[model samples]
Target: MTTHSATLREEIEEMIAVGELKPGQHLDETELAARFGVSRTPVRETLIQLASMGLVVIRPRRGAIVAELGPQQLVEMFEVMSELEATCGRLAARRMTREEQQSLLAAHQACLDARDAQEPDVYYYKNELFHEAIYAGSHNQFLIEQTRNLYRRLRPYRRLQLRVRDRLHNSYHEHDGVVQAIVSGDGELAAHLLREHVMIQGQRFSDLMASLPQLRQGAA
Candidate 1:
């Protein structure tokens, strides 16, 4: 909550975003403290917060390490996200205000512009905002919180998927479909489409894993 704490949190998050702190990599408290010109106390506090967010894990003797990205975890997150998004869409269709709909549309346009610029990372961030706008529009606090948590959990893998061949364009098209369904106030259609949209990532991960011999062998 303090300015120093906020800065430490932001720095840690940026490290994760840029892949400097990769999955399953240990976080060196002494090194981080040296880098930030701070004491171990603040660094430890920041690590604890990150761990609470499921971004890092603090073990008894091992300190904090980046959380491992497992296929099962990805599947579980997507399954939960799909259900949350579907419920959000369904509720938004029936309860959204005019301003909320416009806000969602605006976020979608921002995503389109980012896509046009061929900035996949920017597009992905905006795309998250677009879906999050919809979630907020649903006016379900519990759903919003849960969806945000899952989104954070799957952030790294989602970033990886954006780099897949033509996935950016495909994602754009899917967002269009979701917007159309929501705009038409077709709750059932919107819910179903959103569910499918979220699940597609899981399928892609499966296909990706299948194509990687090393991953397949590791699984066995």
Candidate 2:
């Protein structure tokens, strides 16, 4: 994306993330152009990009509407995401170079700082970096690219999930377990820890329903 389109993309995404744009609401290129003080071309391009993020759906001759995932779909999506993360962790445990391991530790520490500073938004961004590092450390280029794509698609829920009560603290401890397993080259333990961390099963699923009603309600 061009710089202009990238900026507009983020603005539109933020609008969706904050509930300013309800699910299935149409995004008119001309209207967005006017709102953002840009031409329709950039707005069009941004909408297309959002579609790729699974945040918007470009319809036939109908422009774009916010994409909505139903409850079953949400659960299914998380299932796949969990498997992908587990695979990354397992691979990273064995493949990560000493330097890469240190980088992952540093990313984990950044999460610690974000939580201590009472910065949920800061933690959110750092959390993405932390996961991306695991995908990278997997040293499997194909898995890295595939995992990164799905990671972007699921960004909003993951960000909101971090805001649930003591979730930051819980996630920190989860990271500690995964980090220890990876540092010790325990692929099995790392994989299990990461699967549990990302899957949002059992109590974690309940936590999402409680904290992010919009996301959960859409599925219902």
Candidate 3:
């Protein structure tokens, strides 16, 4: 994506993540252009990019609408995604070069900076880098591609997760554990920690679900 389109896409994704643009809501390109003070071209390009990420659906005659996934579907996807991440962590623990390990540590430190700053949005982007570092550390091109595809599709939800009260701090702590396990070359422990880190369940699941209703209400 072009820089303009990328920026527009992130902005739109943020709106969707916070429920400012609820699922199934139409995304009119012209209106979006006006809203962002840009031309229709970039807005159109962003919609196409968003469509590729499964964040929006484009219709034949109609325009684009935010894509919707049922709760069960979301859960199933997360379950599979967690396993993919766990596999990456397992392989990375055994495979990461010294340089790659340092890179991962740098990414983790960047996340810590953002978290300490108490800037969730900044932390969110840094969090992406931290995860991407692990994905690359796996050194498996096909595995990286597969994991990234799903990660992009679920990006907004992952961002939304941070909004679930103290989740940002909790996530940072989890990342710390994951980094330690991988750096220590503990494949089994890394895999287990990564799986637990990514899995959305128990109180986390309840907190996320509870936040959604409030977001929807605010949007309404």
Off by over 4 Å in 1: 1-24, 34-42, 60-62, 200-203, 206-220
Error of 2 at 50 (Å): 1.1
lDDT of 2 by residue, 100-196 (tens): 9999999999999998997887998898989988999999999988898888887777887887889999988899999999999999999999999
Candidate 2 versus truth, CA RMSD in Å, comes to: 3.3
lDDT of 1 by residue, 1-220 (tens): 5567767976676566445677789899999999899998889888887887788899998789988766687677778888989999999888888898899999999988998898977987898899888899889998899888887766655665675567789888988988888888989988998998887454687655554443224333
Candidate lDDT values, in order: 0.80, 0.87, 0.89
Worst 10 residues of 3 by lDDT: 211-220
Candidate with best TM-score = 3
Deviation from native of the Cα of residue 195 in model 1, angstroms: 1.0
Q: In model 2, how large is the Cα lDDT of residue 175? A: 91
Considering only N, C-alpha and C atoms within 3 Å, which residue pairs clash in candidate 3?
A: none
TM-score of every prediction relative to native: 0.80, 0.90, 0.93
Ranking by lDDT: 3, 2, 1
- Candidate 2 segments exceeding 4 Å error: 213-220
Ranking by TM-score: 3, 2, 1
| Model 2 poorest 10 in a row by lDDT | 211-220
lDDT of 3 by residue, 1-220 (tens): 7788999998898788767887899999989999889999999999999999888999999999998876777788889889999999999999999999999999999999998898887898999999999999898999999999999988988888887789989999999899999999998999998899888877887888889877667545
**What RMSD does model 3 have?**
1.7
